[model samples]
Target: MSEALWQPSASVELLKQRSEIISKIRHFFYQRQVMEVDTPALSQACVSDIHLHSFCTTLSGPAAPKTMPLYLQTSPEFHMKRLLAAGSGCIYQIAKAFRNEEAGRYHNPEFTMLEWYRVGYNHFALMDEMEQLLELVLGCGSCERLSYRQAFERHLGFNPLEAEHVQFMVAAKELGVADLVAKEPERDTILQLLFSLGVEPHIAQQRPCFVYHFPASQAALAKISSTDPQVAERFELYYKGIELANGFHELTDAQEQAERFANDQAYRKVNGLAEAELDQRFLAGLAAGLPACAGVALGIDRLLMLAFGQTHIQQVQSFSIERA
Candidate 1:
């Protein structure tokens, strides 16, 4: 088959529906007094998440023909947090986020993200706000709240936290998911696999749910629960089994954050991934003082997909990589 002869496919009506949905999202947030903000898509540093791949580029400048490395942001989280630290109140951004090595029905190398922050709020408060936002945007009446432990218990009949490494391995084997757990012995990895394969599909069938209180080790940038050190103040909203957004109570402890970033760098080295440059500027913001805040990043394209009952991401995008 000739590549030129093949044409990209998507319904015009679906595209219009996507546009309406996006408009509704902006209006909803705007009504809530959330100020929309814009930041640069290119950055001097990339995210430290070992699992995510960032696209790198070089800027050609007249100053000595310098070639400094730049990256297309995977999420606007870092930059947005910097703004929040600077006293921007209740900010939101609808922006393009880029990632490498991703392309599928629900995955794209570049897609829109609806990221927002609420100053002086914790993860639980953010969860409530996200529920209302999803209800308004999707026109759903109500949503559910489920904890990570509850999800594991409800779906797999096991307490993820209490399960030993061997026990988790046994569970995976019984579930016929042994291959997925064999290479990674970490409890979080096994739990993640089971959640994706077993629990998520079931959750998607219900109304949108905010799964909160993640294990501390998986907190990423979220603050640890003061009442329960074992978990972090984090939540992820899921719909139709699709992960729509992730939110957290900001971790203001600069020293702990620095350690986490260093640990992430070490993990990257161990995994044979490129080490990302540390954004000292962002760290300096942390040192200068960051407000107690909560932030979330929603996959805008995925939200559009659920709203329009469309399964593929490329359908909603004007020019996907294949079309481009």
Candidate 2:
């Protein structure tokens, strides 16, 4: 007989590891004096990024307006930053986040995100702490740090930040993914495609790698370097060719942040994507002088998959979406 739909794909032992790792994570933060925080799962404002799709629900109870739309958080970033603005120092959260997407080997619609921030830390400093966390959390050995330009030059034979049109097309042709290069796209878009198709699959073959100094266009909330204005102080962690986390030296300029949000909303509108609530509260927090900090969000389920020596995310999750 076919297995019952209510059954979980993950074994009991895997569930045990999930619990143990969560305990260890809390201890890890506790030892560092980083306070564990909790934030609302649903909110009036949501991520405005064009790439992320947030799940939404209509409120029906007395606690909220009738039929008011509440978007499930994709991450606890905005709320955490607000806390920073309120003078809360160095906080972390093991949060449940939702994103609208297809189920696959590596993805599920809802997942656990372990997010943290460090007051007065740069992206590089955060990366160092992350390496230590990996050693504790995943028993990872050794780490390699590579700048965006270095990685591109080594893998694709081009400097991503300075590549002009002709150079971009040449690199694409060299990588045998010329067709994957979108038509007349932005410079960063082409660079991103090349990174994903050419470089990413070959990264961190034996050791965790921290790729840093991304192009400013791809910074997200990261701060652009004062010395190198074209580069953003952002980094992503990879292990065994798997992207595990992303961190940034956050941008604290309120006016610049407002402009970036407006730009993202405009981009969403132009691309025919639904616009999220503008997160005015988050903007207000920025105006209130948020602390200088670096923050990261790590995928807990993916980390568990690595810890359990599993090939698919389902093998580590208690229940896949289909089972739920």
Candidate 3:
């Protein structure tokens, strides 16, 4: 083994800057009366999102009950929501999140996440606050905005929400990513490819842009928009084509949340992914009446990378996966 592999991935100077940035983030929330909160990094239940893979471990010892399985949280959103149900209003957390994904220029198996919820705020309001934070830390002006349909129309010359699966496939072929799209494509899957390949590169690369009102099928935890039943109240922020944050006008309906979880589990089963237990506690929190709110999870490392003009996520982390 090379001895140099043990050294930190980030320089001392970069780490110092990272600390200052974190401090600024905390202060930003503090001024807004958003309380800082903490939650355990491990849980008995993992996210049901098919796009994410959680790291799992088994407990073994005198206190363990026959090697019970535990999962490293992908984000603190679930526990934070429970706190919201318990009346912890307007809270935030800077947490360590784990995903069983490959380490890359923008990704690592473990990374920092800044997640927060604002009571009584919808997705748009949360977006306003998110942009304000970026302005404070990265010295950015007001962000650009686009709806999901507008983005597709402007760049791909079609409206994604109104397009059929076949249209998406055709777009994929034209974009030279037909093989990347599934042979028997799911509309959402094809749309994701189209956005990643065709649309994202063309949207607000010079500044932060919020693309919102996503198709209902891809809503995840967001509420279906009452104004447009075909779309959800969710939005994502991007800068320089790097996705920075995802926020939702949270779905407070316990039954609807359960159905979404079931749908995700079904997709996992069909795709041969590992099974994850449903987070009943989170659902119960919803049933107990969670406040109307919007929440977002931002990639701290990615934000810092953009702030410091670094190209790689490792440059901002004290140690990358290789060193860790």
TM-score for each predicted model, relative to the true structure = 0.94, 0.96, 0.98
TM-score-wise, the better of 1 and 2 is 2
Residue 297's C-alpha lDDT in candidate 1? Answer: 93
**Best candidate according to lDDT:** 3
What lDDT does each candidate get? Answer: 0.85, 0.89, 0.92
Pairs of residues clashing in candidate 3: none
- Using TM-score as the measure, which candidate wins? 3
Ranking 1 against 3 by TM-score, winner: 3
Query: What is the C-alpha lDDT profile of model 2 across 5-35, one tens digit per residue?
Result: 7788899877997999899999999999999
Clashes of 3: 0
lDDT sort, best first:
3, 2, 1
Per-residue alpha-carbon lDDT of candidate 1 for residues 64-178, written as tens digits (9 for 90 to 100): 2878888899999889888888888889999999999759988889899999999988888888888788877788767888888898889878777677777677778877888
The full ranking of all candidates by TM-score, starting with the best, is 3, 2, 1
Alpha carbon deviation, residue 33, candidate 1 (Å): 1.6
